[model samples]
Structures are given as structure tokens and as C-alpha cells.
Target: MDKHGAKIVSVFSCKGGVGKTTTVLNLAGIYSLMEKKVLIIDMDLNSGGIAVSLGVDATKSIFNVVDDMSNNRFNTISNYIANYNENIDVLAAPKDPRDAFKIDSKYIDLIISTAIYKYDVILIDTTHILSPITLKVLDKSDSTLFMITNDPVDLKNARSMIAIFEDTEKKNYKVVFNQSKDTGKDYFTLFDIKTIIKHNIDYTIDRSFYIKDIDKYVIDKEILTLNKHIRLIKKGDVTRLTKIAIALLDKKKNNTRSEVA
Candidate 1:
């Protein structure tokens, strides 16, 4: 299967409030700082908030582009994109919840295909709701970051999701534990989480100063800006994000090399 010249990653979780959007924004920001052209698609159709959270104008959205495409009014996705910076662009979700109903699953394939040629990476932020659209996005993704927390409910859902992926023979996914806190409790330890989920946690973002102030930073649209005087803990968080970005790029490069061989 051709990747259409870009690495497509979908940030998804089975439970809400596990920091899916936050992870997407931070990852996009890190990639942008690395000078890679990035495009972020808000796939949380029902309650899409990427545009508002990032302070980008959302007068036009994916819904509008799909509508135009369906009517043969347009063949390109360039017009629907809002430029976020030199290296990052955003394709916002529908401004109205009612418009989300018009989005067909077929349009997602078209959007990703058109977007691949225009950007080095396409990041999709998905809702927790396991709708047809969400499943389709996961199916189309080159890599799926399965975001999860240490909570029992979240772990249970993650385990179920993993079971589905296993049954479908989908292996291009990594488990990411986010907003992890150390409460000196053995029950919620890394060992316990792995034991319950039956999968090793590939990465973890422990509680950090930056995460604590994430709400304010997102609201102010300053999430992309790294503070020069950030505390050690926050700096560690940023470093981990950078490492994650590097890991993704490395995986893509390896895949390309193997394909060539």
C-alpha cells in the first residue's frame, strides 16, 4: 500500500479526557519546530475543539470541503486549510454539530490522500466515540497512537480496543500513557497497568509543570512556544515530546528504506 508520500498518524483513545487533543497539539508543535511540514485534522466531529483550543479561525472546515467535493465543486483541500505557522497547517472540524452528520466516511480517504502530497506528516485527533468514521480513520492510519491513562476504566477500554486490533490483525499501534501521576500506590504501578492491558506501555508523559499549565497555554494559543525558563520537570516533558517526534520520523525512514530494499 502506498503511503501517498507522507506519514499519517492518528491520535486516538477509547475514553475521553485522557489528553488526546493535548498530545496531538504538542506533537504537532514539536514536529513544526523540527521544520517538518505538518497538517492536523480534527476528527472529533461531534465536539471538535482543535480550532477553538488553538485559537484558529474555523469559518471553513472539513465539512465544507467534503460538501464541495461531493458536489464536484472542488478537487483540492488547500482552500479548507488554515495556516497555523510556517510549518504547521490545520484542517478544522465542522463549526456546527449538525454539519458533522453530512461527513461521509469516504471523504476521509480523499482528505488524507490529498493532504499527503502537501505535507510531510498528517496528524489526526479523534474522538473517543467508536463511530464508523473513527474506525475508518484508524484503518487508514500509518501509525495509531493509542492514548490511555492509568485509571481502571481507561485500562479496561484500552484492553478491549487492543483485542479488536488483534482480531483485525492491525499491528501498527503504540500504547501511550499520558498525564501519569506518582501517588505511591502499587495497584496503579507500571507493572499493574501492563499486566491489566496485556501490553507494555511504549511511552509515558508523567505529570509536568507544562501539563499543569496546559489549559492556559492552549486557551492563549501559545502551546507551540516553549518557555526558555521552564522548570526541570517541564523541560523533561518537552524533551520526551521531541524524542517521540524523532522516533516517528525514524520509523518512517526505516519503512521507506525497507520498501526500497
Candidate 2:
């Protein structure tokens, strides 16, 4: 979509433990601060945590909506999302893992389209696996954020995927290095990482963003960007994340209408 138009941004990673979900939540927090209505869709069907981490009790999930759509029982987007606050809602992943497999990837376009008009931005947290579902999410996304860490294996895998994006001329993707995940694991410098991956690091969350009590925040259902102490303690980090969110909002991209609908 064009700048400021309703758009979907997909956050995925080379692997599962790379802080992909955390980035999504923090971006949603930043968007809320900007007073933009946001929908956070947990597409990591097997073990998504956006709903649980945010403490939003979603009775109907993405799977339910997809199942309803597949059976011609789907109605409106209102029936699926769980309200986190006035500006934020969540379309959770399946509560049961098996339900994930039953969700048809074909309906992803319809799911996103049904809700795109109702929100200023949709942040989709997808599984690291490149399943059919993930492929469709990437296709529908206005931009994709690839989260990476300082791990050797993760960087290697990222290099491979980013190479493909480069070869295919996918300019709508960004590489966000999450140094906060394992603060002490900064074996490779930023220069080395860019050299290895052959892609510039679009954003970096430094070790300063790392929290020793991250579990406490999760337990208390705290969004780091929304927490006063975190905002104060990690002021630069918060500002950096806001920049990423703002970039996603400002980039005029993927304005073409839905082909599936």
C-alpha cells in the first residue's frame, strides 16, 4: 500500500529463537504510542506467543476464522480478533497445534484482506519455517522484517535467504540485528555480520536493550516499549525500534489490490 495506507508487515526469522515475536510486540507497542490502530497476527501456528505474552485471551483464533472461511461460515473480521486495547487487537494462532495443519494457506489472502481495511497496520508474526502458510504471508506482506542474531548458524542461514531476496530484487525487506537476545554472544561485529550476510543491517537493537528480567515482563504482560521503566532505561533502543515502525509506515509499498479477493 502507499504511504500511511493500511498495510501488512510480516516479521519472520531464519530460525525460531531469534527474538522474532519480541520484535513484533515491541513494534506494536510503538505503533500504539503513535496512536495507530494495529492488529498483531500470530502466524506461528505451532507455538505462537503474542497472545499469551500480551495476556490477551483470544477465544477465536486465526484457525477458527480460516476454518469458518473454508466452510463458507466466515462473516466479519470483528469475530476473530481479541482486543488488547483501543488501538491494538490480536488474531491469535491456533490454541491446538494440530489445528494449524488444517488451516488452508489459500485463505491467507482473504484473512488479511478482511481485516486490512479496519486497521492502520497489521503486524504478522510468522513461523521461521517456510511452510505454504509463510510463503503466502510473505507474498501478501507490504514489507518483511528479517530478524537475526549473533549466532553463526543463524547468520549463515540468513545469508542464504537474503541472497535469494537480493537475486529476486526484493527491495521490500529489511534486516534487523537483535543484539539484545544474547548480549554476550556478540562474537561477530556488525561489519563482519554485514560482510557475511552480504546485506546491510537496516536496524540494530544493541546489548543495552537486553533485560535480565525479560521473563518478569512476560509474566506481567508488559510490552517493553510501553513500560515506563523500560522506556526510560532503554531510551535509545525504544527510539530505534520506533524508527523501524515508522519506516514500515512511511514506505509506500505493495499498493496493488488483492488478487485473491
Candidate 3:
């Protein structure tokens, strides 16, 4: 509710494979360099890639904590968190997809609440599906980055989802045009994509950010932004990501002050 408390950020997409998780981790890497304590909650329960992508061997996960809470076995939140670095901590999803269903949506708020005061930023990685857990995350988020691609199907789906968000008066979201998802999928011009979606593109990830060897980064357990070569070669991309992260957090701070005034 204030500047001292952790700012919740949800990185989401109306369709999958739009660089949502990449954005989350990149932002986390930037925050780490800024000396911010970041907690990334892998909410894509069924097929989450956060732990694996980072190559973190998570022995305990979000499910364990939720189960503990549900059955009165809960204690400190640290029991379930796996440290990714000095500044970044992760709450991984269940290893088994079936376990996704066992956790209650109500526990999402509880988990976040328990960890809220301990972090400077809380980033949630979610699936495209608007499950109860995702809905709860959206409701709790201070700001959200909604990623979209240049694909026709992605635009169509985004347009509909944007319409719903506008209808509900959800003002805490920004549309991120990630052209890097597929460098060759530039079927629509900037104007055409904006016209179709009927929303202003708050940020753009140039196709130049697309790396053919991105898989290698995952294989090597590297955060793109934190990689020295990435910082030198793709410096602009990292800078833009840093700007987006700062703007998202600052926007929430400014809005909070306005409301309190």
C-alpha cells in the first residue's frame, strides 16, 4: 500500500509463447542489479518453466506451502522458497501438473500476503488461462505487463481481452508489443496492430532482441539481462527492459500518492 511494501507485478499474455516468462526473468535480473529484493512466484502451475529455466533445484514449491497452510502446518514462508541469487528468490510451481488442482485459489492471496512485507518486488508468472489463481494474482497486482505479439491470432485474442479489461475499468495494465517472439512474424504494421487491438502500445520489444541461441541461455542457466555479452551486444534491449521495470514500479507509487491525497 506504500513505497516500503513490495510492489506486485504480474507478467501475463492472452496467448502463450509471447515472451511473458522471459520478460519476467529479464525484469528480475534488472531489479537484482538495482539491489531490489525480488520474489518471483511461478504461477503457471501445470507447465511452469521458472525453476527449470533458471536451473534452480527447488526441493520445496508453492504447493507445499499452500498445503501446509490449508492443513495448519504452515510456518514461515522461507521453508518453501528457493534462492535464485542474493537478490532474487523463487516460489516454484508443483512438479506434477495434477497438483495444480489441489491448491485452492484463496491460498494465493494468503501466500502473497505472507510474503508481501519481505520483498521489494513480487513478480508472478502466470498461464494464459484465467484460472482462479491467475484472477487472484491480477486482483492483487499493483501493475501488470500484458505481452502481445504481431501474430494475427494473438492480436485478435488481445483485442478481445483488452476490451474486457477496459469494460471492467482495470487501469493497472500496460500492453507490451514483443516483436522478438518471432522476428519474421511482422505481418502487421505498428499502426495496423494498434488499430486492431484498439489500445496504445505502452512498450515495444524490437525484433532485434530475438536471439536464435536463447535456448542456450536457458541451457546455461543464464538470465539474459545479467549476461555480460547480452548486456554488451543487446544493450538496448536490456536498457528498455530496465526502463519498463522502473516505470511500472514508479507508476504504482505515483498513483498511490494521488489516491492518498
Candidate 4:
């Protein structure tokens, strides 16, 4: 699939601990390697891990930006973007849950629109639980990547999320599987996954040990220094994620064409 301009991709999951944050970070890095400018917005307001995943302190967040905007102290989008290497930028989530309620769809559009003008890919990392902010994010995204796992409880939660999206009548979505250990044991098959969730699995990411470094590098903002360490993990999983990202970009293009046609 060919890439497109100003794509909003949300990495989400019905259940927590499904490697949503890891997938977002690695995919953001991979997209950067593809020469696409990427911005990762951490919308998981309660337990914002994107900053921690990248090894940064989550002191300042989207709350600050929204607060500034409300207080007539609005500035450029560059003010909220934290540099994650040359090609990637990050907008951290609020540390306080109370601040999350303050985030509405209108300001989100402003933030996303501002980033879209400057970046090719906008990756939004969302909280696992349902909330107004999360709904706004999903409703606005061009495509949403719903992360799932082999666990039964996770699949059950995924079903709930799918139901909510279905209720909204939004169709731009794909499923991603994570943390498959494959310990030489017979377990849930892809068909089983499809049967349970009733959605096609777009891609599966194998478990990686260097996952912790994902947080370390992002937190410390040591993209260059962590290059060798991250490189040791190979490009397999992230490459797969990149393919899906490109497909999403293409999907949006096709949708636009269909609308025009």
C-alpha cells in the first residue's frame, strides 16, 4: 500500500497490557525510518506510559497545552511536541485523570490539524478503558489499530470495544495481535481468534526482549545512542507494523477516492 499525507493512526486496545504502548513506539520509530515524519500523541491520560515507554518524564502534557489555550496563552504546536529523534515527535498525556475530562474533541482537532500540517503520520496512543477523550480520539482517527492478544479475557474486552465502535458506525479499523510466545504449545489459532472477535487479524507482533529499552530510549531521548541496542532487536516486528501503517495510509486514500468517485 502506498503512503498518504496527514494520516491519523490510533494504536488502541480493549484491554491493558497488550503491548499497545510498545507497538506505538516501535511503529513510530519504524515509520520514521520509512522517511515519514511521525507524531505520537499519548492520550492514555490516567497512566500515560508513552513518555515512560520512551524513557521521559511525563510532567508536562496535553493538559498544559489545553490549559494554555483556555487561558489565552496559546502558542505553536511546536510548543507541545517533544523531540523523539529527527523524524518523530511526541505529545505526552496528562498525569492527572481529572485533567483528562477537560480534553474534548474540538481542541483535539486543533492539535491534530496542527500536527498534520507538519507531519505525515500522526500516531495517537489511547488508554485501554473507555472515556470521552478516547471516544473523541477514535472518532477523529483516519484509522484505528485495535491491539489484541491470545488471552481470553483480552478477547472479551476486545469484543466490547468492537461493539462500541460498531455502535458509532465507524469502519476504519484493523486488529493487531501481540505477545505471542509460541512456547511450542498448542493454543489459540488465528481462526480461533477470528471466530472469537469476528474481525480479521491484520498483523501479529512477536514478543521481543529488548522491549524495555523501547521505554528507556524514548524516556531518555537517546535515539542515537540507543540505535545499536534497538537495532539488535532486528526489524521483523516493526517491519510488519510498517506494512500495516502503509496499508492504513492507502486505505484512507481509497476512501477519499471512493468519496470523490
In the range 1-261, model 4's lDDT, one tens digit per residue, is: 123357888888888777777667767876777787888899887778777666655577899888888888887878877776788778898878788778765688777766677888788999887676777788778887889888888887787767766665667777887754332322588898888887788777766433543445655655422366556565565556667767877753423210100
Tens-digit per-residue lDDT, 127-218, candidate 1: 99888889888888778889988678888989998888877777778889885433232348788899889998988886652344556776
What TM-score would each prediction reach against the true structure? 0.90, 0.94, 0.95, 0.82
lDDT of each: 0.79, 0.86, 0.88, 0.72
Sort every candidate by TM-score, greatest first: 3, 2, 1, 4
As for candidate 4, its clashing pairs are: 53-215, 54-218, 54-219, 55-218, 55-219, 55-220, 56-219
Put the candidates in lDDT order, highest first. 3, 2, 1, 4
Model 4 misplaced stretches (Cα beyond 4 Å): 1-5, 56-59, 96-98, 181-187, 207-233, 251-261
Candidate achieving the largest TM-score:
3
Q: Residues 1-261, candidate 3: write the lDDT tens digits.
A: 345689989998889989989999999999999999999999999999999999886678888998899889999998899888999999999988899999888898799998998999999999999887887787788888899999898899999988877776677888999998798887999999999999999999998898889999999988999899999999988899899989977853433210100
For candidate 4, which ten residues in a row score worst on lDDT? 252-261
lDDT of 1 at 66: 92
Clashing residue pairs in candidate 1 are: none
Q: What's the CA error at residue 176 for candidate 1, in Å?
A: 0.3
Off by over 4 Å in 3: 1-3, 251-261
Best by lDDT: 3
